[model samples]
Target: MFDVIDFLQTVGQDAQWRHADTEALAVALTEAEIDPELRVAILAGDEQGLQALLGQDPFCCLINPAKPDEEQEECDGSCEEEEENDNDKDKENDKGRG
Candidate 1:
């Protein structure tokens, strides 16, 4: 038998939770020493006092490419610019072919 709550309990583990996004309101719940079940309730986002506890500009993306350890300064945003140009050229090519 498997439990989803038990499996994702890394959010509750001290070590694992340390690596998680500290900007989330969940951090406050953890810091307050709230019970796991109560903490889960706080994640509802609609609860009172929840917004005040969360960071103003918290990490919003669950799959953000940017990380504290990695640096993308070398690319200088050129990769994305080139990709957009490539897409434009692709659309033009398709139109001509059609």
Candidate 2:
């Protein structure tokens, strides 16, 4: 798995392989012992095909702190639940002090 990933990184960074013709790229892939399915996907420049062959899709999440005047987007309720839990803990502490 690491070798395959390394080969892909090398191909991406190295201009020789990046700009190579299909036949040359095919030969390079064969020499690198990359899986035939992966080789086909790479040669065809099919990103979705590669993801299908690998059995996973890319996932990403970006988070930024809201500015004072900016409205925050609603999430899936977990954040709200966490804040409520924290408020409950603070109330419990107040009761204990009393």
Candidate 3:
């Protein structure tokens, strides 16, 4: 996953925490080092530089939906924990009956 903080610092400049801007198309030219050419372009608001930078990465440009309904059903962890707790309770009840 991309580091949102780094990208925000790149554009927002000294943004304490929040950095994601859906409207602003941030093109990541390098993973670790921000290219001098790109840095100059961002500071100067150079249109051509922005255009050129877009060509550098394809997958990074697309804006993902705010709430991806398709993947909402997928549980990260909390839901699994709740399911496990319910199973444990059921197992205990079964042991008592047995």
Task: Tell me each candidate's TM-score.
Answer: 0.27, 0.60, 0.27
Better of 1 and 2 by lDDT: 2
**Candidate 1: residue 35 lDDT (0-100):** 59
Candidate 1 has a TM-score of: 0.27
lDDT tens digits, residues 1-98, model 1? 02323433545565655555636646665665665654664565334443333323434567668888987677678899999999999999999999
Cα-based RMSD of the predictions, in order?
13.1, 12.4, 15.2
Whole-model lDDT, model 2: 0.87
Q: Please count the clashing residue pairs in each candidate, in the order shown.
A: 0, 0, 0
lDDT string for model 2 (1-98, tens) is 56668888988898777567999888988999999989989889899998888777889989887899988787887998999999999999999999
Give stretches of model 1 more than 4 Å off.
Answer: 1-75
The local distance difference test score of each candidate is: 0.58, 0.87, 0.58
Candidate with best TM-score: 2
> In model 1, what lDDT does residue 89 have?
100
The residue-level lDDT of candidate 3 at 3 comes to: 40
What does candidate 3's lDDT look like per residue over 1-33, in tens digits? 134336645556645324534223433435445
